[model samples]
Target: MKAMVTTGARQMVVREVECPRPASGQVQVKLEYCGICGSDVHYYKDGKVGDHVLDHDIVLGHEVAGMVSEVGEGVTDLKVGDRVALEPGIACGKCIFCKSGHYNLCREMKFFADPPTPGALQEYVVHPADLCFKLPENVSSMEGALVEPLSVGLHAAGTGDVKLGQNVLILGTGCIGLVTLLACKARGAAKIVVVDLYDKRLEFAKKLGATHVINAKKEDVKKRVDEIFNGEGADVVLETAGSVITIAQTPFLTKAGGTIVIVGQSAQSEVSYNFSEVIVKELTIKSIFRYRNSYPVAIAAISSGAIDVKQIVTHEFSFEDSKMGFDTVIEDAENVVKAVIKF
Candidate 1:
């Protein structure tokens, strides 16, 4: 088996590694596709994200889906031939957060491509059965690979409590932002506004049902959003850019008493936020980690064509050209919205 290994900063290569076998309550998946995530390129280029640094030569990919080649004992619902999406977070089921059904917030979680955990860039990965979700017959393996990111979008909408006929503002046009657009539309948001610096991504967002697209680089995001909302503001604001400025602007851009959900992970530990603006506006600010228990719903949405994630996939590479895929994404950030590695 071959895997993409990042031995050092700006260093990556395809190396032969032993195939992984399933442990108890786990299954070995013969990977068909793994989406090259932003974090993967971060680890490959800078060797770290915030405080989480690459410890060992890690295989870097988390958005994974494939067919089950082997199933361990006690795995009854899934069989050897089932195609499934692999949720990359392995949480300690007994933790307080896990016990409270917020498994994504579990303190003791081993997330793929985060640091030490070897991710799904390999030919075969042994994952816990509980996290392996079976794909519907109508869903393709490439679509399965997108469920991981789409789950984030669903969770963001759920956290913000978006509802029918609400005006929503998304402060980024990345994969998560676009998926959040789909989720909001599905939840009956009458007006969805997407903001980003990239014209291509904004155009893509408009085609995907966004009522308005704002180029933050050219137009005033807050003013434009105010105009869209008739001089008030959006009912719910989703910040997915992971920048300090965007995170700071969320409270002010949101309507009074509206909810602001932070979906993107910021690079800085202590972001200087405007607490006075939040207090004055009486806003509810919430943050999302990764997703929990959202994969199944995302799969159903993608299968039903409610979410067209396939269009977000702009580039695809074979497992052999994994390094090139990473490089291409890092170099062509604007042109490549989503990149995948097929085995």
Candidate 2:
């Protein structure tokens, strides 16, 4: 099978690789679509994100969906021809975190797109049958691939414990931020405000159901957030930009007693935050490391017409043009929200 391999910085070469067949308790999926995520772009361009540097050849594309072509000997639940969206992280089910139902933090996890773990960028990928989520009739393989990121939004909203009639602020209009906006609206958020410097992304956020959009490049983020909240401040502030500035302002943009959910990757730097302010406001600061026990809900939401996962995919490229697809996203950050590669 042909796979996109990142040999080095900003380099992706589509080379033939030996396709792994389904092992016992696994399923071989003939992948149809895989979303080129921001992390993939970062790895392709910067060769790293946070502390995990790319030390070897890596295949990066966790947001993937496909059709089952074969099932392993012990697999019972799924069968051949079933459409699926793979929940990329395969956790060690026996870890303390996994036993406590926080498997995303499992000490040993083989997440796709992460270095050293070959991802689903190839024509076929053999994944554990348990992690393959069956897609319904209403959802396409492309939308199915996007269930990964949508799960993050759901988890972020879940951490905030969002309820009906609660005003929410999302700091970033990137893919995760837009999905978070959709998730908040689905959960009955009273008003949604999305902040970003890019106007194109802000427009996408508005289309995804943001009540208000703020351009951090032009307006003071906190000032506009105050105006939107009637000088009181937001009930929930979700920091999804991964920028030091945005992470620092999370507390300032949120109201007393409100929760702040940190959903983006913070590039492995210890950014100074006002912990004293969090103490005084009695704010609940929740952090997310991918998602656990949320893919099914996100898939169901998209399948049932509750959330439009397909809209997030703004660009698409074939498997052979995977390099361009990944490069375009890194270079054209303003226009491309989500880019998918067709296999």
**Number of the predicted model whose lDDT against the real structure is largest:** 2
Q: Rate the local accuracy (lDDT) of all candidates.
A: 0.89, 0.90
Error of 2 at 121 (Å): 0.5
The runs of at least 3 residues in candidate 1 whose Cα sits more than 4 Å from the true structure, single-residue gaps closed, are: none
TM-score, model 2 to reference: 0.97
Residue-level lDDT of model 1, residues 79-142, one tens digit each, is 9999999999999999899999998888789999877777888889999998999998999999
Judged by whole-model lDDT over C-alpha atoms, candidate 1 comes out at 0.89
Cα lDDT over the full model 2: 0.90
Clashing pairs in 2: none
lDDT of 2 by residue, 1-343 (tens): 8888898998889888898889999999999999988888888898887777998988888889999999999999999999999999999999899999999999799899886777778899999999999999989999899999999999999888889999999999888998888899999999999999988888889888999999999999888887889887889999999989899999998899999999876765789999988988899998998989998999889978899878888899999999999878978889999999999
TM-score of 1: 0.96
Q: Give the clashing residue pairs of candidate 1, or none.
A: none
